[model samples]
Target: MNTDNGLAPLRHRNRWRFSGGTVDLHRPDLPARTATLGAEPAPVVLDPTRTAVIVVDLQNDFCAPDGWLAGIGVDVSVLAPAVDLSAQVVAAARAAGLPVIWLNWGNRPDQANLPPGVAHVYDPRGTGEGIGSRTAPSRAPVLTKDSWGAALTDGVGSAPGDLHVDKYRMSGFWDTPLDSVLRNLRVDTLVFAGVNSDQCVYATLVDAACLGYDVVLLTDASATTSPSYCHDATVYNVRQCYGFTASTPDLLDALAAARPLDAGHRTAPTTPKDSE
Candidate 1:
């Protein structure tokens, strides 16, 4: 199922199977009745049009080779696929006209209110520079704070129509304008992808679910310090506890299908005249 963009179609495996007192058959080719076995009707299909992709803290400190955690035994190799997936998701979202919000972490001059031992390990000021000093491009609408070592890196900037939100906690919505932004965008579903899957990503998903937003965790578009624990916990929580967990390819397919129909209505026809 190659999309128009030249990306291959998402791969789906059939899990359903047909079994009876005397007969058995593969699921995909089985008749609906045989497969259902007197079960209830099929589940309702969700409309992905109201979905938005929220990228959380894909920064130098977490994803790049010379990041703060680089020396802490963080295996960034797991992040390579995530970065590629993120790029694919972004491209698909932009093409389909869906919103792609990048939540970057930034720091202030004073490292006030930081978690104990965090400042010692990760230097906010470029002075004690570690491997993760490169920041996102200035063009991005960043949320700069000193509380957590999650600020957005340099070089990545927000585009003209993109929205930026700031936070001072693990959850992006904890003390930020995230809810308001989602409301304004009419976003009912959120696709999450970013760094530190076990910590920030998990926290955001839990919060998002609590706020009544349908969430999808892009398993391949996220990573953590300890690849084993981070990846395992993320998959477990998303699949069993929080919400739907999908691979980057599946997520891209869903987003591409939903974007065209949803994007047009979310934006205003004319730019508001603030008189510049």
Candidate 2:
């Protein structure tokens, strides 16, 4: 199906494979593997020291009941499981000493950087209620950088050692230092978790894969308010074209297994309940 992007395969393969400056998923070595609908596989072991967990757009505005999404009438409760799973993933990743990068929609203070079309999508009232614009009733600014709305949700916060990237677009790489930061830290494998699985999270994963970073989507750790079919499509697209789909438990088990015997393999703790 031409899943790979035409890069040379790695000599020592594990669950993640490299091709044409992008990351590809191979049949994972772990006994409990996450389903990917149907995608071809190669293999590469995950290096904890060189891996990162990317928490995408799990901010107050998107996750909290009083936040933007809720205020806009979207059923925010759908993300409850995802929020819990994300917290667990963060906790485990932190314990494992893996870098946790929180990628969020943190727009500029002046809102000049927000494109009109993007602003219009969220500001349906035409009442100056746009990105960085304050809602009249609650006075919550849409998602200004450094604002409460832009902060990571209470349960899933950035640890002292974690990194934060304020992304202005759906894709984390757009005018953001995410790519450079990962390269600088020598992080080639990325585990994704966050809200709106079919949107922001999906966009960022695709970008990460295209930029040559191995990507894993913790399915249970991400949620989307979109229809069930939309979520399915996103997962299928990721497995077939971008990367692999795994539950938090699958990844945690893999990390735990790798910790004891090999320095190349690091940590993660506990199993996640199925979020589905």
Candidate 3:
């Protein structure tokens, strides 16, 4: 058994713990565990070289004004600021030589797998647009694998070296290749930023924790049109149950510390006043 920075070695082969939480470090043979009950610890200082920023569900159907949520009268403007913040995180991650993984909700073309319970959320406006369903006027699929609505928003996009994974469920790990991808990359730390902080982002964050990945939630870079309470609950849950929450600026500082000579490493701007 070994310890570092007050973390006690676990009786289990791969788990470790500090005063506040437990994290099952990734290993090939065993499944990972998430968090435990205790006081939250100070935010983690990440090793930029070993971390990856996961931009989740930043797709047009979730973030853009002309997309499905907007067409249904949802005020997607609340999610607008995250677009730029996520771009900043991506840029910083790339400059630091960290992988930026875009994990978007990409449904199947035939709509064969979407369950009724999962499809009911889109029926509120009677637009009939749900998973794999197209919008009335523009005819874009709600979230088809290769369709426009499922693509990352205009400003938040994938770069040549960045990774892209299409997820089918709210939790990116469910029936997806996300776990294997991260494990294959040997990435143990995941920085999460994306749309609907309380929904898709939160789900993925929790799943990552359970899978033995150190998780960080970028508060400003993750947007949600859901009620403020939902956002608050997600943040609280993540901090108390999964991992720490941070801003884009905090992550930038950590990355900068790792590479002081990189002039391209810059702090992300504060989110606009209109955002919650």
Candidate 4:
């Protein structure tokens, strides 16, 4: 049972209670799982059990045709690839026993927590077409909590074990319970797939790395409405500075072989040059 930490009757990983005298800081009896992915700058090999997949800001407001980005004249069609790959990654993660977290930009209805600079950037002219403003014809507030604009896009489905976190800022960790949730789940690695590769996605991934979580950015599973240069540099920096960058297929291949699936692409584990 690998009961190496505490008394069997009171052991818990990342959890403790002052029971009688001894506390149970032992991690639960979860199976240790690992897999390898074909990645850039290096191949990726990670523990699926200690890892989580975070889909950031793929909400209707960011990717839907009639949503906030589109309302602001940003072409949302460019997000199709990201949406598809993210959906696939999320499904595979659920099957692999890895947690799937949807980090969406669902702001407070009153915009009480929204900073003035953020509000100005949304509606620079102060014309009331910004976040939480009923500027659109349908009058649904942009990214308001529990609003249609804050809902997941059509193709992204939520399963029973999936976790959802709403963030007011670009980084999901800031002013959110994201970090705490991940820690309690015993997640040490983050696989990110989402929109605005250079913006929210990048910010979250960077913060994840800074906070000591291993980060993997799925290249094909992320997209940016901005120019190609922004997307290119984001990937480059992820590999060069933050973490590794791998394709969606690589991740899926790793998960399938690592767990029960028999139909996923498979690859042998390889050591990255730097690690060797």
**Top-scoring candidate (TM-score):** 4
Q: What is the C-alpha lDDT of each candidate?
A: 0.57, 0.72, 0.72, 0.81
The local distance difference test score of model 1 is 0.57
Instruction: Write candidate 3's Cα lDDT for 126-156 as tens digits.
Output: 5566666666334788888878787777786
lDDT of 2 by residue, 1-276 (tens): 101122221212133545566665542232221222221243345666567899989888888888877887888888989988888888887676667788999998987777777778777677876787776224668888877788777566555556778998889998889987787556678989897899899999998999889888877899899998888888888878887888877777766655442333232221221111
**Which order, best to worst by lDDT?**
4, 2, 3, 1
- Model 4 CA lDDT for position 102: 86
The digit string of per-residue lDDT tens for model 1 on 137-218 reads: 3222222343223443333333445455655567888557788778766667788887778887888889999999978777
Local accuracy of candidate 4 as per-residue lDDT tens digits, 53-150:
99988888888888888888888999999999998998799778677788998999888889998788788998989899776434679889988788
Worst 10 residues of 4 by lDDT: 1-10
TM-score pick, better of 3 and 4: 4
Which residue pairs in candidate 3 collide? none
As for candidate 4, its clashing pairs are: none
TM-score per model over all chains: 0.65, 0.77, 0.77, 0.86
